[model samples]
Target chain A: MSDTMTNTQATGGDGAEAPRGVENLPMVKALNAGLRQAMLDDPRVLMMGEDIGRLGGVFRVTEGLQPEFGTDRVLDTPLAESGIIGTAIGLAMHGFRPVCEIQFDGFIYPGFDQITSQLAKLTNRHEGQLSMPLVIRVPYGGHIGAVEHHQESPEAYFAHTPGLRAVSPSTPNDAYWMIQEAIASNDPVMFFEPKSRYWPKGEVDFSSSAVPLHASRVVRTGTDVTLVGHGAMVTVLLQAAELAAAEGTSVEVVDLRSLSPVDYGPVVESVRKTGRAVVAQEASGFASIGSEIAATITERAFYSLEAPVLRVSGFDTPFPPAKLEGLFLPDADRILEAVDRSLAY
Target chain B: MQFLSTDGVFSVSEQSEQYAPYLERLTEADHRRFYRDMSVVRAFDVESANLQRQGQLALWVPSFGQEAAQVGSAHAARPQDHLFPSYREHAVGFVRGIDLLNVLRLLRGVTHGGWDPKDPTNGNFHLYTLVIGSQTLHATGYALGQKLDGRTNTGNHETDEATMVYFGDGATSQGDVSEALVFASSYQTPQVFFLQNNHWAISVPVTTQSRTPLHRRGDGFGVPNVQVDGNDVLASFAVTAKHLDDARSGQGPQLIEALTYRIGAHTTSDDPTKYRTQEELDSWVAKDPIARFEAYLRSQNAPQSFFDDVDAEAKDFASDIRCRTLALETPDMSLMFDHVYSEPHPLLEEQKAWLAQYENSMNGGESA
Candidate 1:
């Protein structure tokens, strides 16, 4: 094995007997580990963003990468979002796996034209002559009381584009595995990191692999109602499931890992078994990822569903200030309220 | 701006003198070949615009007055160097060994893009980026890749390769263009930014695009930049060749603002008369690059038979392109979903089947 692979394997902090035995790590550190492993496995892997090198990113997800791999691989780009993505597209065309960070969700719009017009369409436009093996990492969602643009959830816009794959990981373990999987895939992946969960610790096993990047997973199973969500909202759904269980009402929580080609198979199965569902997200309810989940569940599990598919999402208003964000975001209370309504029906 | 004078006089500035060796290295045969290339592509340009007017092509972006800027720089680039062009770089595409009809396939609305950029026979020329100023960043990124692979800065002129991207004056105003300049400067990527200041950007004049010279904008981004008489093919060739050499030898990025004029409308859809005046247009017409070069070749005792042979070849080439464009066939409808992902996408497969079924329904039956 190469030195980087050995380094990651040794650094995971778990003894060899438990192949899946993991180390307790935050989402950011897990992402860092994933990026480190990916770079070690493939010399072609590159990380580019503002403040990614010395600053290790605003979130520090790419921390220590420059020192470990050298600045050539972990590039510190100028403050230009369009340039970052456009150049990354070029690098991808020239056979480099570029993982670009938009830093925050709100700042991604400037580079949106490049991502949608060039990165997304390059492969299809070139008639398969080119493959864009690129990953655009954006820290999205709200909970830590950040201001506007910083807390926006723009996955719906990217998921709507046919040529892009949008995926989000709610836990550190998934973050570790999915980031590596995204780098390995030939398609361009829009990786949404749940910033609220960046500091949350979880057992991240580097020794073994996780599920495929695009597949949805039922994190916690119940029979009364299916609470479907992804990214940060998955935590809220899990908490709501717990709260509902105490009330003698069972709730199944499904983390929709990949938003674009949402693994509707598991979603449909969960909804059919539970006979009720509620999709939760921090983004506004109008034409959101939650809407797609609700629509898909209704179509695939129409006869099996006892109540209409409901959604517990943020109000259809602009992302408010830090003080009002808590009121705007979907939490366990709102999720429980939606579950109660679904159960009452 | 007039190095090779409009009156067939060849004068060299100190800057042009640095590149004079490149010009001296060229033989009578090379000059004739350059003249032939310019003449042939111009004929092809005129024929393309005519086809658009005659309702053959959906739209045509004419390179009427900007042939010299493209042909000269394209000739200067090494075979291993990657080239990125905006839509109107017809001459560059031709020099890159692309079957020019492939470009027509795109303009004719029969294909998404014409040729595979990675195809070696296509001269390492990338597919044309229709979006203004975007290709500059891609070129810079490709140059960065070259640097990472140790493909450049080897101190060996022949083995060291660089990248070149072409854009118009108006594209310089774009955020992506400025960003590309910033990244190229920061990374010291081996690349050249070839901006053709073709006096008019559709209806907008170059004056409105930048207050200072476009090359000066590169100075603020830390890239060494120069302005050339874009109409003088020799200046374009010499300057581009030198700067490309500098970039290949680890001199970082260089910018060349080629001062030229667009003799035709931006596209067949444009009305240039509304924005530009007849006096300005007539003045630029006198400094036509191909005409001036033809005059210089004649002054150098070029034979009449050579010019006659080039003219004949240009006519035949134009006719050949017209025939190929007319004979172009639409690809299978299934091709739409073919390259959406390298791996099969279930949703795309379902949509492809739906479209096929929808088309079959129009034919009064569904396939088994």
Candidate 2:
């Protein structure tokens, strides 16, 4: 589950190093590998979260880390979110790169001020005299159907903040590389891990990454339409792309790995060729990542558009009961319908 | 418990006698230095309030009657320790190695932070946290870091580190404060929570903030706690010195509730006359920290010339601060985008460049 880049092809954009050794792992295992490698590389890298050490987290993403890295480096912190984040900021100021885990997306609100006000503003407040090299790993999004407050997509809250970096990984390989890259970064990063994809095994090319942590990638190519999304919504977008292609729609799917400071290069290029686009997300459409992408695409590719940029997203409401999550979350059918609306023009 | 009387006589009661040895560590030079600093900060506070009244500053947090608590506790901590201050620790900053003018830069609206704590000139005093009680958690975390790094409990006060966080009584009600105390006790971190119960949180009384004595609040968290007469600078120094020594020796976190008073308005903008009667204010004024220490100096047969010299030095210190503050220039517009992140952020960089170009275009048009 844990493998490092062994230097196959130093510079390529996609996972084409099949001749190189690869591992089949879930996003959880991939993230574990990435965190382990980062800790091994730097003595300052530490992991602190509730139940992260002894219980290996509620998701078990931090299993075997405490025994290997020792309890001092991998801490099972007290059950307090604000304390975890607040102390982590102090730890960062004391010259440690702390990667904190939020048990769930909803639990993060308890630590919201430390994250948004203190952690986000410390570096800027110190006027560059200090650097907050911290990572808050949030397991988010729907399709798990465990309970209320368990499944959510709150990346927009962090993405809207100016001093914080927000990113999500849609695949195992991206999870492995992006977590490492995020750890290596000197700024505070909100690492939104899609909980629904935690169990799905995918190809993790430990040899190299397809793109930089902040860059978006066109996972599939097409000529008629471009579908853009991030995290769990990305899998739904790919499913919709496959369905649209069956109907001869030829949809291109773009994985928006980075939420804040979004890399619109690949998405804009694909939309230029396709002449239409639909942005989807599990988060509510109003004032969300999906809305931002649609607005930006319309501004940058106004002349090339075949239609107004369409959005397929969660309804603007609190995540309903687990039974209603199916209707609430954007699926292949909802995205295909938005694709139909975009293609109509 | 009070160790220094309001008449400036130094004595130890049964409860405070244990802290008496800590005072022996202080030389006569330290005693004279404490009196001098308390007077200097009082002068600085009055001049800063005047500056705000003259519209030179946007607002001012007066440290009028709380100087003894701040200065004494500040001196107790070693150089290796980190101090996280609330917005009105002017006396603490003065007793520490920070230039008193940097605090004015914040009130003057020229900078969010006046100086870098890492800069030797500024000492190890971190930035002022206005949100209240927020810095307690930060200080606790810093203590945890020291503990994890094996920098605490080394039986060497010179090498071992501790954290001291200052907050007012009103901040104790904040959830972050409780969380910080919990974390500190749970981790057994080397830290001190210095709560300046100045009797008033703006208009609300300390009675509104707590039902029990504030020091015992730490008892609920299982942290060792004590209460002292905050106006007695000698008592403050002795108690703080003992606890700080205990914490560095890996005795876990300690809490000190310093009972003091706020003689002036909360800030320059507030009207204390609106809230309280003159009798209440006058009684606290009688226990003024500077006057009390002056009495002690006189009891020790200190010369009138020495008192006159201190008054002269205080006037010079305030006048110097006034001159320097008037000389501070408005910050550059470009600095607004700087330091948002340590690395180059594409979005901020582009926005900064666009703003510069837009401003330049406007300037060119004006010239034409």
Candidate 3:
């Protein structure tokens, strides 16, 4: 289920050497490998979460880590989300890079106060005398047919915070590299893992990442309309781009890697070329990452437009039951329909 | 739970009898130091409240009644140990060698926190946590780090490290406090939860916050718990010394419920008269920690000159803080942006530049 191999690439100057072969692994396994590699590299790296130890997490993303790192390094904390995050802040103050796992996106609210009030502010509160080099790994978004709390996209909450870094990886390779990069960062990061795409396999090279974790990548280039997506929605956007291409729309796809401090440069550049864009996500269409991207594109590329910037997102309703998830989720059809509306202009 | 009777008599309880040796070990110098620290903070506390009333500070959290609880436990900690203080532990910070004026910097709205724990002069005393119960988790986490760093469980008291976190009764109701206890006990972290049960969380009473005594709350979490007469400085010192020694020597976490009272209001903005009875305030005043310690010191043959010197010194110290506070300068506006993150962040940089440009444009002139 998991494999670790060297990344065959030139060494990065700051000692980020992929220094062998890419491991084709699922997103969960790739994340595990990245965490394991980080722990192996830095003594300060530690993992804490509920059921993360003997149970290896509800998602098993931290599987086999407890045994490999020993219980001291891989702590199975008491069932307290606020405690996990609050204590992780304290541990970070004590100079440990703690990666905390929230069992589900909904369960994160219990720890939300710590994340927003304390973890987000400690570094600034101390005037840089301290740094919260912590990563909160949250398995988010829908399509797994799980209950109310399990499937959510709460990136907006973290992204809106001034001091915290929020990022989500849409693929296995990005998960492997980004988790490691987030842990190595000297600031707190909300690493939202798209639970629906955890099993999707990709070539995760251990060699090193080509760009900084914050940079957005153009997964598929096109000309007529640009389709912006992140996390699980990026996969759907790719499908929409392919569909639009066959219809002679030639839609470009941009995977927004970092939601906060968003790499709007590439998105802006793509939109300037395409003249139109549609941002998509599973979150409801109210003050969401989709709304933010649309706003940023509008601000940066307001004149370079064929039509008004549009959004294809989940309706403003509580994430519906498993039976209605397909309708609730932003799929290729909804995205291409948005593409049609944009192309119609 | 009481080492000295409230009537100014030195009498030890059975539970506190175990700490009798630590009391005996306290030299005249230790006693004088405790007196000096307590008096200094008390004077400073009074002056700070006056400053708040005079519009010099935005607010003040008075440590008027729980001096013994803070100072005793603070003195119990070794220099190597880390301390996490809830917002009102001025006496504790004083014992930890922090300049009392640094606390005013926060209440005066001059800085979020005026001192850094990493700076040696601040004495490893963490910045005060205004949010209740949050510091306990931080202390537990830091203690866990200490244990992992092999700084604890070494038989040597001087070498082995432990941590102490202070909070009030109101904070006990928070989920974070309970969670911190669970983690501390589960991880066997070398730590102390020094709860100054001051009987009020603002206008709310301790009775409303707890069904049983607060000390027993930690018992369910596997932490050894004790309650001491927080007004009795000797009891606080002895009990804390023993528990901290035990924790550092691998005894894991301990909870000390220091039974005290908030003689003053919660803050300068609070009116104790509105919520509490005059009779209750009078009763707590009668059990004042400083008065009780001063009486005990007199009974131990302390000279009048020594008492006069301490009182004079406390007054001088308070006056110095007042002078320094009045002379306090506002930090650079750029500080707000300087350390939002350890490394340079593009967003913060942009914000900083925007702020600078906005300030530069204040005179309604275009950029050169």
Candidate 4:
């Protein structure tokens, strides 16, 4: 229907034009493009997970990848998370870098044992003698009007492990670059892609000025207060900052690119400058990444605080209905309310 | 090396010649070392069980009577070969050069995994896998990697490599095991599927897990399979060596089922006395692998000091394990965000910040 061959560059200045290689495509299309590039770059690269082939993935994130790569490379596996990851580990050991999909955040539990116990420790147990060199792609977080087990933020579980690397991307540009970067790492990486942002289009640069997957990026700049978020929440944070700007409050937004081995330098520097910060995410407030960052700021930059660090997070309950998700998710109003509260303090 | 037959007389298989040449290589001194390693590993197993009983561990899977099966096969593997072990392979970990303390740390709930597997010097031993039959798939995959890397049957004894994966009768029932077998058979992956048919899976017995002999499951998957006396260290060693060598030579995947018994509770949380009788326990105890090996060693006129030295070594190793386990420090609570991904994530930053504030507020504005 569209000119698939025309890699038309998107308009310049705001960086909204189609990328040099992928012109005017949706997030899912860009993902498929990245997968194709990765497969061509490395022969060891293979894709396997549930409904990834033939069915084209639940979200069609892997649409057309199977036909191009063939069934041997892009495998549609049986309905077993443990089997998917367990086999991926075997494939990795045999010199194949498997990019496994866990289908959804809630469905990753069955394979949790394999990922945390076997895949995470295979390299460390051999005392650095072996490297898993595999990538696990999980579509996580809530915001889609979906039912139970479909929307969950379980990044904390994997982040707690010692040997695995965890990361998530919010934009099409970061998604394209990060997926390829994750596959090239010697360590095992758990790549969490926000399902809600899968269709959102953004400009991606394939010319490799793209930051490393583990580094943080400052998406929006401000001075009065810092708004920190990631994955789907990054987009929300940027929008919230824009809304705050109309009300004359400057907001600095930090898009933490990596979950584990976090680049706290950018976050701490921003907090030290702003003296006021509001952390927002869709995951529950109990024992979450928000808790870790809040504590680190207090410890590392206690004197810089003009007020206590404020957090606007989802309720400490199961992810609610799509109708309630708007209220449940931290929107511009909730973020601005926290910012106002922090300013008042 | 045979000390007993099915009829209870000293006998060796006609295939013994293949291993007999290596028997003389294991002099009295070497036998003493192997015995010492087994004794220490068994002591570690007992102490781990005690720790679990005392609530120092979340759970403990004892490898009491199955030590010979583990140690014999582990010792038979070359340094270059890799090992993938199920959770119960405590003795195999010891033989593969893992410190006894690391095993204790895992059972004590201090860490999910106790070691790194990538370091060739870690003796190519992987962390203990808790999922029943999953490691079989990993082993097969690793074996395939070895084949592709030109590491198998390189015609150089010092450089050629193979892989061994250990599981139990219960794991044989898992779909992953059968799938791994099929893949290994088709690819001719240089791997040995070492199944320790230890007679029980928690409360379920061997009969409940499989309709026929567990080894036969491999045959249906197209992997050549064999059965061995798991209680006989010499037999286990001979059989595993043959299979491993065959795999290394690119002859394809092989499955060896070691018929053994779980001489203790399935774990500290279990009480077998409810389902099995003391009579069954007594029967397996009489066929204790260590005792059988000891008898054969004595008949060979092995020195009395060898047994004395092994007992002393076991006590010392047990003391070290206890000391190290008791001294382990609780992990930093903030380490909760350390390994989720190799890259930075904005959401995690927000969550970490929120947690810090929550904890500090709960702690009366003091840093937590």
TM-score of predicted chain B versus true chain B for each candidate: 0.98, 0.98, 0.98, 0.94
Instruction: Please give the distance, in angstroms, between residue B230's alpha carbon in candidate 1 and its true position after superposition.
Output: 0.9
Strongest candidate by DockQ = 1
After superposing candidate 1 on the true structure, give the runs of residues whose Cα lies further than 4 Å from its correct spot. A1-20
Model 4 lDDT, full chain set: 0.80
True contacts kept of 4: 0.38
Residue A265 deviation, candidate 1, in Å? 0.1
| Per-residue lDDT over B1-368 for candidate 4, one digit per residue giving the tens place of the 0 to 100 score | 34254233446666555655545445666666667777888888888888777777778888899988988888888899999998888888888777768777777767667776665556888777776888888887778778866789977756789999999999888877877887678668899999999898988889999889888887687788888888877677777887898899989999999988999888888999888888988989988887877777777777898789888889888888778787898876544554443334455567778898888889899654
Best by lDDT: 2
What is the per-residue lDDT of model 4 for residues A209-313, given as tens digits with 9 covering 90 to 100?
447778887888899998888899998898888998999999999988788767788998999999998888888888888877788778888999999988888
Candidate 2 chain B lDDT trough over 10 residues, lowest sum: B359-368
- After superposition on all C-alphas, the RMSD of every candidate to the true structure, in Å, is 2.8, 3.6, 3.2, 8.0
lDDT for residue A79 in candidate 1, whole number 0-100:
88
Give all candidates' CA lDDT scores.
0.89, 0.90, 0.89, 0.80
Worst 10 residues of 1 chain B by lDDT: B1-10
Give the CAPRI rating of model 4. incorrect
DockQ-based class of model 1: medium
Q: What shift in Å separates residue B366 of candidate 3 from its native position after superposition?
A: 2.4
Score chain A of model 3 by TM-score against the reference chain A. 0.94
What pairs collide in candidate 2?
Answer: none
- Residue B14 deviation, candidate 2, in Å? 0.3
lDDT by residue for model 1 (B1-368), tens = 34598776898776577778777757888888889999999999999998998888999999998988988899899898999999999999999999999888998888888899888999999998899998999999999999988999988888898999999999988999999998899989999999999988788878898899999998799999999989888888888988999999999999999999999999999999898899999999998999999999999999999999999999999999999889988889977899988766788998898998988988889762
